[model samples]
Target: MMRWLITGGCGFMGSNFIRYWLKNHTEDYILNLDKLTYAGNPDNLKMIENHPHYRFVLGDITDPQAIESLVPEFDGIINFAAETHVDRSIAQPRDFILTDMVGTYNLLEAARFHQKKLIQISTDEVYGNCPSGQNTEQAPLLPGNPYSASKGGADLLCLAYHQTYKVDVMITRSCNCYGPYQYPEKLIPLFITNLLEGKKLPLYGDGSCIREWIYIQDYCSALDIVIQKGKTGEIYNISTGEGIPNLEVTRLILQEMGMSEDLIEMVDDRQGHDRRYSLDASQIRQLGWNPEYLFSMGLKETLQWYRHNENWWRKIKSGEYQQYYRQQYAQRHKKSTLER
Candidate 1:
């Protein structure tokens, strides 16, 4: 029975992964380390808190002492810790650098010294705007904003460690993921929760920017395979290749919720927002993996999740997120019709 450490385990994707891992790998044990940041809600994994094979530790990856003490216990590490939100990153770039870059450095050092495998979770935003064909794993990183820049910096550090120190590390860069237990700060969850509460949906920059989406389960399954079979010092991209414009997704969400189009508020676009992002998942597919859920099936499941879990998201949106929301989107004025 292998024991693993999953950092940032209380956040949306990380929490979902813990549930997925423990359910499928009954013999394996997971120790979850989280700082309990704003997006890291303990409620996400409330059902599995008492699982015999799972344990939670309240800690930060930024602290070298904490990571050094823990890395030796686990056979390997899967790092999900980061300052993820783009809006928040724009307002506080230093935090993103500190966690996404420096925190990753600490984990790398610990893993290097302990001779353990490290799986770094990354994102497609590192490629910035992809106005044309799909980008392969070898595509150059041209991160536009502070959030993507920080992530890109971490990815580079992982590669450097693998090359210079012979650290057993692999990186996975995934497209946008949507599913249950996602904090409302993200696009899909924010729109879903807002529609549920009869609030206006903020559509940025006429909502034309395109992005690929993948179900959380599909990503978890892909990651599981990566952990078991991925090559050391290699990078993989996980995606559904299902690209759609933000406006279309907003309209689809409105249609699914039986809400009027009037609920869409055309707000000013984010600074340096990429026009599109798409990845060719040929490498992962060659590893005998493929996505199961289409956007329609995933969207239905996601909507149902938020529909029933009102109390979970309501508590988050009503707390510190409210103040940040006001600072981020509340100040954005509706774009003039002439600009459209």
Candidate 2:
């Protein structure tokens, strides 16, 4: 059986990937390593905590000693560890730089020394705003925010390792992913949980910024395909080709929840916010991978998940979440402050 190490497995997409792997790839085993940051919730993977083929390692990727000890025991490493929120990155760019770049470098070093295959999970933000056509794998990197810049730096590091050291590496850049177990700090879950809690949805600027949406499950499937069939030293884009405006997404959520648009509180726009993001994803499609859920269906399922799992989100929205939410949006609540 093939053995794999999945870093950041306690986070949203990572947890979904772990569950997807356990369910579909019975012959493979997974060792999950997560630093359990604010966004990393171990409860997300509680279902698989006791599985025979599953293991959890509480560690940080930036810790060379930690990665060095584990690299020799795995066949491949899929790195999902990153500081992902744009607001968080703006407030603390150093964290993003350290985690996304330095941490990735450590992983690359360990993987290179052990001659282990490595997969770098990245985001479409690295391509910056795609105001016109969809971006292919060869598109130029023009990251706008600290978070994207850090991710872009990590992507470059992975490519550099492949070219300079001949380390087995592959990269997959995906669009915005939404579904169950996502931290409420993100857009979709934030809006859903806000409405559920009787709070006004914080709508940024005019809410015209657009993003390509991909369901978490579909994203996991695409990652699996890349890991199994993708060629080393190559980059793949994974997208559903569904571009929707932030305003429209908020309206849909409000409509689905039987709430009103009046609850949307217009807030100051984020700093260096990209106007749009799109990915061609043709390369991954050539590898026999396609998104299964349409935007409408995915929205419905996501809303239903939040509706039924009130307790799960309630616990998250309490205590630390309240402090974070206030810190993130309190200044934006004013009309004069527009930066970040």
Candidate 3:
């Protein structure tokens, strides 16, 4: 059985990947290492916590010694650990640089020393805005925000390790992912959870900024394919090619929740927010991978999940979430109210 170490396995995409891996690749063994940041909710993988082939390690990738000790135990490493939220990055770029870039460097070193294959989970934002056409893996890196810049730096480090040390490494840059267990800080879940809590949805700017959406399950499937079949030292883009405007997405969520557009409260635009992001996922598709859920169907499924798991998110939104929400939106709310 192939043994793998999956970093950041408590976060949204990472946890989904763990569940997907355990379910589909029954013969493989997994070791999940996570620092359990605010977004890394253990409850996301509570269902499989006791599985025989799965193990969880509380640790940080930024610690070289920690990574060194674990590197020898696993045949491969899939790094999903990152400071992902754009707003959080803007507010605290230091954490983003330290985690996304420096942490990745430590992992790369461990992987190189152990001669283990490495897979870097990345985002399409590294290409900045694609106003005209979809970006291929060959596109130049032009990260707009601190979060994307950090990730871009990490991606470059991974490729450099492969080229310089012959360390087996592959990278997959994917579009926005949404589904169950996602932390509510992101747009879709934020809107869904806010509506559930009798709060208004915070719509940014004119809400014309566009993003491609991929269901979490489909994203996990694509990652699985890459881990098993992808060649080392290559980069792949994973996308469904479904670009939708932020306002339109918020409206869809409102519609799904049977709420009114009147609930939307337009807020100040985010700093350095990319206009649009698109990815040419044809490369990964060529490796016998395709998304199973359309945006509409996936979104409906997501809404249903939130409806059924109200208690799960309700508890989260009660404490720290309240403080974060106020800090992020209070000023924008004031401005919006004045304009109205």
Candidate 4:
């Protein structure tokens, strides 16, 4: 049996991967390690909590003792632990730098000591705003925000570790992921939950910015391939290859729910918003890992998940979300008012 460690296994992407891997890899076992932050909920993994092939440990990646002690217990490690919200990174750059960059360093050092095959799960934001041309694995990073910058730093850290210690490392920079179990703070979930609740939906900067979204399950599939067959010291881009404008996606979503554009509230745009993020993931595609979800089909399924899981989101929306969300959804929103 293949024993593995999954950091941030309860996060949106992590949980998706964990669920898929556990169900599909009957002979494999996983140990989920998570800090259970505001965005990470243990409820995501409740279904498989009792599975013989799965176990969980609550821990932070920054804790040296914890990471070192557990590094040797697994055949592979996928790091999904990150402070991922861009808007929050603007207000709390230090925190983003801490978890995304510093925390990765902790994981890398521990993995090196244990000679573990480490897959550093990263974001396309590390490549910064993609220019007119499609970005490949070699694109030079030009991150604009603390969030992207931190992820970029972490990518470089992985490269450094590979160069210095010769640690077996595989880095995967995936585009946006949306699917079940995602916290309601992200775009698809946030607006879906708001639209369901009859609250005004906030769009950042006319919502014209574009991003390529890979369904969470497809991303999990890609990661699974990378873990099992990827070469060490290689970078793989995982994306749908087409960037969709935020407004178009939002409008489509609202239209699907029988809502109108009139329900949208035009708030201020986000600071340093990247106009577009596109990736050329042909490298992964050529490796026999093709994505299986279409935009409309994936979106419909994701929308339906939120629709079906109202209780899961309603609980989150009633607290901090009640206060910070409407404005945080758009960078143009002034916190001074939300604070009141």
lDDT of 4 at 271: 91
Predicted candidate 3 versus true structure: per-residue lDDT over 1-340, tens digit per residue: 8988999998899999999999999999888888777777777887997788887777789999888988898899999999899999999899899999999999999989989999999999999988999999999999999999999999999999999999999999999999999989999999998998899988899999999999999999999899878999999999999999999999888888788899999999999889999999999999999999999999999999999998778757776544464244333322221010
Candidate 3 lDDT at 269 equals: 96
- Listed in order, each prediction's TM-score against the native is 0.94, 0.93, 0.93, 0.93
List of clashing residue pairs for candidate 3: none
- Residues 1-340, candidate 2, lDDT per residue (tens digit)? 7899899988999999999999999998888888777887767887887788888777889889988988898899999999899998999899899899999999999999999999999999999998999999999999999999999999999999999999999999999999999999999999999988889999889999999999999999999899889999999999999999999999999988889899999999998889999999899999999899998899999999999988778877786544564334324322221111
Model 3 stretches astray by more than 4 angstroms:
320-340
lDDT of 1 by residue, 1-340 (tens): 7888999988889999999999899999888888767777767877986787887777789999988977887899999999899999988899899999999999999999999999999999999899999999999999999999999999999999999999999999999999999989899999999988889999899899999999999999999999888999999999999999999999999999988999999999998889999999999999989999999899999999999989889878888544564234223311211110
> What is the alpha-carbon RMSD of candidate 1 to the true structure?
9.1
Q: CA lDDT of each candidate?
A: 0.90, 0.90, 0.89, 0.85
Q: What is candidate 2's local distance difference test score?
A: 0.90
lDDT of 2 at 244: 96
| Per-residue lDDT of candidate 4, residues 1-340 (tens digit) | 7888888887899988888998888998888877767887767877987787887777788788878877777887889999999999999898788888888999899888888888899989888887687889999988989999999999999998999999999999999999898888899998999999999889998888999999998998898888777889999999988589999988989889999899888899999999999999988887889889988889899998998988778867787543564224323321211010
lDDT of 1 at 92: 84
After TM-score superposition, the amount by which residue 29's alpha carbon in candidate 4 deviates from its true location, in angstroms, is 1.3
> Model 4: clashing residue pairs?
268-332
Q: Residue 278 of candidate 4: its Cα lDDT?
A: 91
